[model samples]
Structures are given as C-alpha cells and as structure tokens.
Target: MTFVIQLMSGLAVGCIYGLVAIGFSMIYRAMGLVNFAQADIMMIGAFLGYAILVAAPGIPFWLAIIGAMLGAALLGFVIERVAIRPSVARRADQVYLVLLTLGIGIVLSNGARLIWGADPVVYPTGLTHQTLTLAGYPLPAVYLYIAVVMPALLVGLHLFFTRTWLGLALRAAADDPDTAATMGVRPALATSVSFALASAIGAAAGVLYAPISYVSFDMGVIGVKAFAAAVVGTLGSIPGAVLGGFIIGLGETFGGQLIATEYQDSIAFAIMIGILLLKPTGLLSGARR
Candidate 1:
C-alpha cells in the first residue's frame, strides 16, 4: 500500500511534467530553439490562479484556472509578437531570443513578487476533502485527476497532430519551414500558436500542481524536470515525454525514500545524462532531429 501510494504520488508529478513537456517538445520541433522561460511562465499562471481565487473568493476554482491559462496564452502571444518576432527579424541569432526569454521570465517573476508578495501562497485544493481508499490506503483526489488527465491529453494531442489539418501544418513547419512555406503554410504563425499552446499546457500543470505542492515562486524547477523528460523521451516524441516523466517521477519517489533524499535532484539529472550518454538519440527511435 505504501509503495502504491508513493508510486501514485510520483505519477501525479510525472503527469504534470509530461503535460508541460509536450509543449516543450512540440515547440522545439517547430522552432528549433528551446523556450528557456517556459517554467517561469507556468509559475506565473499558477500564481495568477491563486491571486484570483484569493481576491474574489467567489470565483470558482476551475474558472480561475481557465482564466489563468487564457491570460498566460495571451501573454505568450504578445511576447512572441513584441519580442521574439522583432529579434528574429532584425537578427537570426538564437542566443538573443534565448536571452530575451530569460529576461522576460525574470521580469514576470519579479512582478509576481510585487503583486503577490515575496511570500509564497498556497491554492486551496478545492479537492481537499476527497480520498480514494482501498484497503485503508488513502490516495489524494488530485492524484486520480492527474493520472486521468495526462493520458486524455496525450490522446487528444495525438489525434490533433494526426487527424487535423492545423496539426499537420504545425508538423510540416517543424519538418521544413521553407518547404512548408512553399506549400503556403506560415511557420511564424505556427511558432506563435506553439508558444500559446505551450503556455496553456504549462498553466494546466501549474493548476494541477497547486494542490499537491503549495504554489511558490520556486516551482518553475518543475518545468526544468519536464525539460529533462523531453530530453529523455526524445525531442519530438509525445509518448516519450509521458514515459520519461513517469520514470523520473518514480525514480525521485523511491530513490528518496530508500536512499538519500538530498540526492533526489541529482538522481533525475543523472538519469538524463545516462540516457543521453548511452542512447545519444533518446528512448524513442523516430523522435530525433
């Protein structure tokens, strides 16, 4: 029962990582550059939901999450238009865009500090009272939600990528933007949509994560974990992200319990390093560039 509980808890965190990693993977495939500040954006959305709920106590929790997601999506769209687009146009240097994103993240985090205060605030679980009990082993309702949501999202994404025309356009842009353009597809538009999608996914993770771990300025590291998951699963593999996330999640849980908890962070990085060192490509074969 204890082991099941532990694995399930890890699954929740892993699912969040998987959800965020899908955006990271998809965007990278489309744009060839990593969104360095994705984690920070997620943190901002999480905080936005908390702020809304805290202020209007009348706003439903689910509504707050949707509002936060939309707000983050709009912010991403604006940032891409105002910052990324201009930088890409003026100079093709990748580092400039990378630095721009990092700066944007810093600005948002600091702004959040001012608005929400430096002190971290926890979002009410809204699911706090429920538990699934099996033979006296208690599981948080949030875990069940995360477990279901991740797979549902993955299936939806798979269908969107395979069955929808826009999804095909995104993939086409990812494969070859110039050729895609030759076919009348716009890569920049895809990039913008990718950013918005990434932001929304990150916001979702933040909402799902709020109850499990108190919302904090520091939660962006969860985004880093998702990045690692993306790396391990192979850059463009959605299933790989989910698989890698679960592996990391389970590893973090059992490794901490049986070994030194201080080494948990290192363990995850070590896995990433080991996978890259051994496979060089990633766990999935077709996911490489």
Candidate 2:
C-alpha cells in the first residue's frame, strides 16, 4: 500500500514535469530557440494562482487554474511581441537569443521576489492535506487531480493540434515559414500563439503542483529536471516529453525509497545521462517536432 501510494505520488510529480517540458518542446519546435524563461513562466503562473486564490477565497480550484493560464498566456504574448519577435526580426544569433531568455528569466525571478517577497507561501486551501479513499486505500487528493488533469490536457492538446485551423497553421509555419506565409499562415502570429499556448500549459502545471508543495520564486529550479525530461524524451516531441517525465519521476521515486532521499535529484539526471548514452538523440529521436 505504501509503495502504491508512492507510485501515484511519483506519477503526479512526473505529470507536472511533463507539462512544463511540453512548453519547452513547443517553443523550440515553433521558434527554433529555447526560451530559458519558460520555467520562470511556470513560477509566474504559480504566483498568479496564489494571487487569485487570495483575492477570491471562495473560488473553485479549477477556476483559479484557468485564471492563471489566461494571465500567463497574456504575459507570454507580450513577451513574444516585445522581446522575442524583435530579436527574430533582427536575426539575432542563437546564442544571444538564448542568453536573452536567461536574462529575461533572471528579471522575472527577481521581479517576483520584489512583488511576492522572498519567502515561500503555501496554498490557503485544505486540499494540500486532503486524501481520498480509492480501491480501499487512501491517496492524496492532489494525486487524483493530477491524474485527471494530465490525461484531459493530453487529449485537448491532441484535438487542438489535429482538428483546429490555427493549430494546423502553426505546424505549417513551424515547418516552413515561407511556404506557410504564401498560404496565408503568418509565422509571427503562429510563434506568438505557440508561446501563449506553451505558457498556459506551464501555468496549469504550476497551479496543479502548488497543492503538493509550497510556492516560491526559486521553485523554478524544478525546470531543470523537466528540461532533462525533454531531452530524454526528444526535445521537440510532446509524447516523448511525457514519457521521459514519467521515467524520471518513477525512477527517482523508487530510487529515493530504495536508496536515499538526498539522491533523488541525482537519480533523475543519472537516468537522463544513461538514456542519452544509449540513445544520443533521445528515446524518440526520429519523432516529429
């Protein structure tokens, strides 16, 4: 029973990593540039959700998630237009653009510190400690929430990318901007939309994760593990991102139980390194972006 509970907990954490990794993969696929600030966007979303809950103590958790998503999406659009688009227009070097994202991330983290303070904050709700009886066993309510949310998100994303016009246009633009433009698919708009969608997803991860842990500006460090998941799954493949996330999540969880809690982070990276050694391009090397 303990093992089962630990497994579920790991899966929930993995889902969060997968969600953030999807953001990294999407931005890379659409813009061919890694936005290091992607994690900071998640931090911002967590903060936004915190603010929403504080403002409306009676609001549903799901509603708070949506509010965070929309707020983060708007922020993503503004960042793309004001910072990323101009750099692309000027044909900035890839290194410079990556550095720019790092700078932006630093600014965001520090700015958050100024606004929300350096101290970590916990959710005001009791869901953090709530448990549900399932299969004659008790499990954290947040785990159930994650299990439902992750699958729903995957399905929604699949439908959006497969059945929607804007989604198709975004794919075309990412594949070939010039050809897409001739077909009336604006690359710039696609890029902006991609960032917004990615940011929204990252925000969702933040909101879901908040119930399990304290929210802090430095929480973005979890992004490092998520990045490893992206690389292990294949940098631009959505399914791969999720797969890698689960692998890291489960591995670290069991490892911590069998080995030591202090080695959990190391176990995640070690798994990444081991996988990379065996499959240089990632487990889904030839998979689509």
Candidate 3:
C-alpha cells in the first residue's frame, strides 16, 4: 500500500517533468538549442497563476491556468525574437546561444527572487481536501487531476502534430529548415510558434506542479531531471517523452522504496546513463514526425 502511494505520488510529479520535457524536445527539434531557462519560465507561470488567484479571488482555477499559459507563451515569443533570433541571424556560435540561454536563466531566476523574494511560496491547489482510497490506502485528489491533465494534453499535442497543417509544417521545419523554406514553410514563424507552444506547455506544468510542491525560484532545477527524461525517451520523440517520464517517476519511487530517500534523485541519472550506454539515440530512435 505504501508502495502504491509513493508510485502514485511519483507519477503525478513525473507528469510535470514529462510536460517540461515536451518543451525541451520541441524547442530542440525546431531550433537545435536547449532553452536553459525553460524551467525558470515555468517558475514564472507559477507566480502568474498565484497572482491571478490572489488578485481575482472569484476567478476560476482553470481560467487562471489559461492566463499563466498565455503569459509564459508571450515571454517565450519575446525571448525568441529578441535574443535567439538575432543571434541566429548573426550566425553566432552555438556555444554563444547556449550561453545566452544560461544567462537568461540566471536573469530570470534573480529577477523572480527580487520580486517574490528568495522564499518558497505555497500555492493553493483548490483541489478538494479529500483523498481517494485504493487497496486500503489513501491518495490525494490532486493526483487524479495530474493524471487526467497529462493524457489530455498529450492527446491534444498528438492531434496538433498529426492532423493540423501548421503542425506538419512545424515538424517539417524542424526536420530540415532549408528544405522546409523551399517548400514554403516559414522557418522563422515555425521557430516562434514552437517556442510559444513549448513555453505554454511548461507553464501548464508549473501550475499543475506548484500545487503539489511549493513554488520557488530555484525549483527550475527539476528541468535537469526532465531533460534526462527527454534524453532517456529520445530527445525529439513526443511519445518517448511520456514514456521516459513515467519510467523516471517509477524508478525514483521504487528505488527510494527499496533503497534510501537520500539517493532517490540519483536513480534517474543512473537510468539515463544506463540507457544512453545501450542506446545512444535514446530508447526511441526516430524523431517526432
């Protein structure tokens, strides 16, 4: 029963990592660069949602989530236009772009600290103060919300990629920008759209996770674990991201259950390393199509 409870808890948190991994995968697919600030952007979303909850007490939680998503998406677009695109235009070294993202992460983290203070803030989950019982064990209702939200979001993303023209174009641009340009797919627009989508998804993850864990400026460190999940599942594969997330979640929980809590976090890295040694391209080989 305890194992089950821990597993459920891990799954709920893992879903957040998977969502962030999706952003990492999408941005990497389109731009060939990781937004080191991806996690910080999620922190921004948490604050935005918290602000909405405080400023407009009557506003629905769902509506506040939308506001956070929009804010994060706009921030992503601005970053792409102002920082990434200009550097790309100048044919800057990849190291410079990577450094730029790292710098942006620092700026955003410190800026958040300045505004919110260097303290963790508890978010009001608004979930019922109730627990569902299974096998004589109780689980928080918020777990159900995370479980439901993750699948729904993934399905929406799959539909966007497989059914929509713009989605297909974005995929094409990611696969081959020069070829996509000749085929009338605008690489610049696709890049901007990818960043926006990634940021929105990251924000959604933040809102979902903030309820489970306290929101703090330094919480973006989870982005590293999510990146491990991304690499474990296959960096550019959407389905892989989902698989990798659950694997990491389950592994950490199970490892902690059998071993020690102090080493729980290291389990994800061990799995990542073991998997990478066996499959360099990731467990899933093909990129998202």
Candidate 4:
C-alpha cells in the first residue's frame, strides 16, 4: 500500500513535468527557442484560477480550471507576440532568438512575483483525503483521480496531433518550418498555436497541482527541470517527453527508498545529464523530424 501510494504520488507530479515539457519541446522544435517561464506560467494559472475562485466564491472548481487553461493560453500567445516575434523578425539568428526567450522568461517570472507577491498561496481542490479499502489496504481518493488525469491527457494530445488539421499543421511545422510555410501552413501561426497549446497544458497541470502543491513564484524553476526532460527525450517527441517524465518521476519516487530523500530532487536531473552524455540525440532518435 505504501509503495502504491508513492508510485501514484510520483506519477501525479511527473504528469505535471510531462505536460510542461510539451511546451518546452514544442517551442524548441518550432521556434528553436526555450521559454524558461513555462512552470511560472503554471504557477500563474493556478493563481488566476485562485483569483477567479476568490472573486466569484460560487464558481465551480471545474469551471475555474477551464478558465485557468484559457488564461494561460492567452498569456502564451501574448508572450510570443509581444516579446518573441519582434526580436525574431529583427534577427534571423537562432542564438539571438534564444536569448530573447530567456529575457522574456525572466521578465514574466519577476512580473508574476510583483503581481502575486512573493508568498505562496494554497487553493483547496475539494478532493477528500479519505482512504478507501483497495487490495486489503487503504488508498487516498486524491491519488486515484490524479493517476487517471495524466494518461487521459496523453491520449488527448496523441489524438489532437494525429487527427486534427491544426495539430497536423503544427506537426508539419515542427518537422520542417520552411516546407510547412511553402505548403500554405504559416509557421508563425503554428508557433503561436504551439505556445497556446503548451500554455494550456501547463495551466491544466497547475489546476491539477494546486490541490497537491502550494503555488509560489519559484515554481518556474520546475519548468527548467521539465526542459531537461524535453532535452533528454529529444526536444520534439511528444511520446518521448511522456516517457522521460515517467522515468524522472520514478527516480524521484524511489530515490527515498534506496538513497536519502535529500537527493530526491537531483535524481531525475542526474539521469537527464547521463542520457545527454551518452546519447545526445536522446531516447527518441527522430525528434529533429
């Protein structure tokens, strides 16, 4: 029962990393840019939902979640438009664009600190801590629901990329931006949509995480870890990000059992470095495509 609980908890948090990594991978593939503020976006999404809930008091939790996702999506699009696009247009160079994203990330995170204040905030999710008897052991209801959200989200993403025209266009842009542009798919629009999708995913993860982890300005650093997951999985592979997230999640979950809990945070990152050192291309060989 304890082992199962740890696994469930790890998977829940890992799902957040995986979801954030989606944006990390998407931006890297599309614009060749890495936004360091992805996790802070998640933090802000939770805060936005929290604000909505506080303002309207009667708003349903589900509705607040939807609002949070939309809010983050809008922010993503705005960031790409205001902070990234102009610099990109001015400079055709990749490193210049990368530096631009980094600057944007710093600005966004600091702005969030100013707006929300430096204190952590908690938003109740109404998920009860009551334990249910399962396999002759008690299991928390929160863990059960959380375990389902990740796989369900992954399936939804898989379908979107494979079935929908927008997703197909995005995938095409990720594969070859120059060719996608020639084929009547605007790479800029694709980048905008990618940011929006990634932001939505990040916010959705935030909504799920709010009940579990307290919201704070420093949450953006977690996005950095997610970036590592994206890199370790290869920057553009959706499936690979999920797999890498799970691997990192497992390392953190089981680290306490084998090693000390003090090293828990660094376990996944160490694995990421190892993967980078051994196979720079990552587990998925075709991410550049």
Top-scoring candidate (lDDT): 2
lDDT string, candidate 1, 76-166, tens digits: 8887888788888887688777788778878877877777787778775466556788568898776766766566667877798789999
Better of 1 and 4 by TM-score: 1
Q: What ordering of candidates by lDDT runs from best to worst?
A: 2, 3, 1, 4
- Give candidates' CA RMSD values in order: 2.0, 1.1, 1.7, 2.3
Q: After superposition, how far is residue 225 of candidate 3 from its true place, in Å?
A: 0.2
lDDT of 3 by residue, 129-226 (tens): 45788678898766776777788888999899889999999988988999999999988988899889999999988888887777798888988888
TM-score of 2: 0.97
Give the range where candidate 1 is weakest over 10 consecutive residues by summed lDDT: 122-131
Off by over 4 Å in 4: 128-141, 286-289
TM for every model, in the order presented, reads: 0.92, 0.97, 0.95, 0.90
In model 2, pairs of residues that clash are: none
Q: Tell me the TM-score of model 1.
A: 0.92
Error of 1 at 55 (Å): 4.3
Off by over 4 Å in 2: none
Report, for every candidate in turn, its global Cα lDDT versus the true structure. 0.79, 0.90, 0.85, 0.77
Candidate 3: which pairs clash?
Answer: none
**Backbone clashes in model 4, listed as residue pairs:** none
Q: How many pairs collide in each candidate, listed in order?
A: 0, 0, 0, 0
Question: What would the per-residue lDDT of candidate 4 be over residues 41-100, giving only the tens digit for each residue?
Answer: 887787887887778876766687789989999999998888778878787587777776
